[model samples]
Target: MKRWDAILTIDKLAAELIAENNYKGKIYATGSPAFDKFRDIDVAKERKRLRKKFGLSENVFVVFYAGAATPAGWQEDEITFKFLAEAMRKLQKKHPEAVFIAHQHPRDEKLGRYQKLAPDLKYFDISKFLPAGRQGKIDDTLLPMMDTVVGMYATNLIHACYLRISGVSILLPNAGGKRLFENLSLDDFPTKGRKNFSHLPKKPPPSRRPMRLKKN
Candidate 1:
């Protein structure tokens, strides 16, 4: 491994995975290339197009959720999805104009859950809205349009930070979990294997305001 060229990691999780595998190499955590790829996009135009495609208003508060790509047997992820959908339903009463959009894990393996869950909730799915091969564009566009993002641990959070979108991690509770809340950081993630929901924000937190990256 040392003889190979430099190892580039997209984010901290990738670096951690490599380290856990005991690969001692020159790993550069250079961030997501996807971020750089679509950084210069005309966001307003993309926002308009997406809203039109989803039948949503331009000024609606958009909450986007990112799902995982796992087997249908992954019960934990399914539970989390249900919990989030219910929470969003409760939130919609407060902001009727708010739109909830679900961005399935890009691999397409976990898209079925959305088909089953989105209709009753009246949420839109990014996979259904964007054409094939447009995942990068969707990320670049929707991350900026979203008011707050709810998802489990995923690289979407890194992109959210790149766009300064507020991301809330949904944690599974311990024991016979009845509720859950937004855990802002990795350290705040709850223990695995139970249902939970609580303390959700009606809008994006102040800390999530789009960042202005200054030159060093």
Candidate 2:
């Protein structure tokens, strides 16, 4: 660890650890430049372009599900997907314009996790739109194009925060109630009184302040 002049991290836990350990190197928490890139985007403009390019109507309630997977096991990932699928189904039924877009984990594509978990989602229509994620350029622009972001524990929530989109951490039934973010659930989503997803206004609402950039 002493070989480097300094250390850089994006999370508070890491920065705390560095200080607690009394590392002699200079340490700085430079938030992900990748996520910061979309903070100041024109959300309404991006939404129009993406909808047109994807053949979606302006009124569609676009819900983006950013998938996550771990090498340890597929149990949690399966539960998360299943819950999201069902929740989206209900959301769509209540609002005919709703559309769920799946941003699958890049590795899940290779491992075919969805196929194995297929049996659990017998009645839910999980196939609406599937998009590639984590790709540098595409992901940076993708968050701005969505109406809302949903996921478990993933870095995409940070991007959602910067993009000023409402992000919800899905706490699936019977699974760990541990949350990555707060106050969003199947019961509360419908009552949030958010604007219609079909069309965006001339300007987007303000977002939380982004982490200031720092030199490493």
Candidate 3:
């Protein structure tokens, strides 16, 4: 194993896998990435466009969410909703124009469950509104309008950090899970996951660009 080559790992299962191979490499654990991969998208433009198409004001804070939906690890699972509701309520209180836009887990069968919790959020499970190859139609359409993006235990968080999208989130992986294991050697490989992690978002845009900031 290369002294600088690290195995970004997650969970006891991953640790065991690495240990079994005697792979002497640095390991980085991050909150989660099952639903990660969105921070890499430049959805702010699409969000703005969608808001205009839907008659949303430019001042509105558009919080975006995309990624895995389960604690047990399914393509689409029911993870958490309380934060979304709270976010919506808070945004409404601070800026009534704030809106939450999200998508289903793409692999999920039950859309009703999500709708039941926050029917107002724009949910797209497998669209390009996030980051990836397909780059859905809505994604291009929705990116510009988003003042910010948001989610929990999502790869979208990573994407947000990637695209420099600013926002907030919660429900990260366990303390010792992916979050801790994924950045063991950030000093040597500083930008390693900085792009994606920066995408996780914050309540307000940071003082510095997500990418320009040091690894967390």
Candidate 4:
């Protein structure tokens, strides 16, 4: 497939894939320019400001669910939403300061479906805070404020990992789930163990080295 003169990739793994697939184009693993916003950010100060702006106390335990739109047969998004809602309900009973919030994928047409799916559980709609054009830029504005990010194998978890925020993936019971879990080290709780998420650290760890993707 010699279709182009050059290619730019987000990471080394992606560059390697292109080479492995026998693509003869010039490949550069320059990392994504989108991450530039994270470079000089004062995470602590920004997080505090956002928390105050959002009417959350400094000590609040913010659990953010990053929603994704899945294919028809793969109900991972719906399953994960219900699971997270129930889990958060139990978590809130124990920690009254814990706040659960969710942001749906900007492209997902079924907006506000989670409210109907889990009517008993209440969660903050963080998307409402986004400015008109910034709805798709949650990684820049909202992710740093989260104590923990939950999703069903969404790419936002990668951004969460970069921000030093704890990430969890509660995937569907299928081969795709197994493969995704193996690729990312985010905590994978079994069906029975999914009800409990008390092990998350109260505060995110200090900034460390960038994440290295696991090889299959």
In the range 65-167, model 3's lDDT, one tens digit per residue, is 5534544343223344545566566666776656666655555445455667666655434343345765332332344455565555555554455456675
Best by the TM-score measure:
4
Q: Write the per-residue lDDT of candidate 2 for residues 121-182, one digit (tens) a residue.
A: 32222333444452422354666667888877667877787778889876543332322212
- Candidate 1 or 3, higher lDDT? 1
> What are the C-alpha RMSDs, in order, of all predicted structures?
13.9, 14.9, 14.6, 12.8
How do the residues 164-198 of candidate 1 rate in per-residue lDDT, one tens digit apiece? Answer: 66888765662112122222322233333212334
Looking at model 4, how many pairs of residues clash? 0
Residue pairs clashing in model 4 are none
Candidate 4 lDDT over 122-199, as tens digits, reads 577666676897763365466778899888867778777667789997755542253344333233233344334333
> Where does the lowest 10-residue lDDT sum fall in candidate 4?
182-191
- Candidate ranking under lDDT, highest first, comes to 4, 1, 2, 3
Candidate number of the best lDDT: 4
Question: How many steric overlaps are in each model, in order?
Answer: 5, 2, 55, 0
Judging by lDDT, tell me the better candidate of 3 and 4.
4
Candidate 1's C-alpha runs over 4 A off are 1-32, 38-55, 108-111, 115-119, 125-129, 132-141, 174-216
TM-score of 2: 0.56
Models sorted by TM-score, best on top: 4, 2, 1, 3
The regions of model 3 sitting more than 4 angstroms off are: 1-50, 70-79, 118-141, 172-216
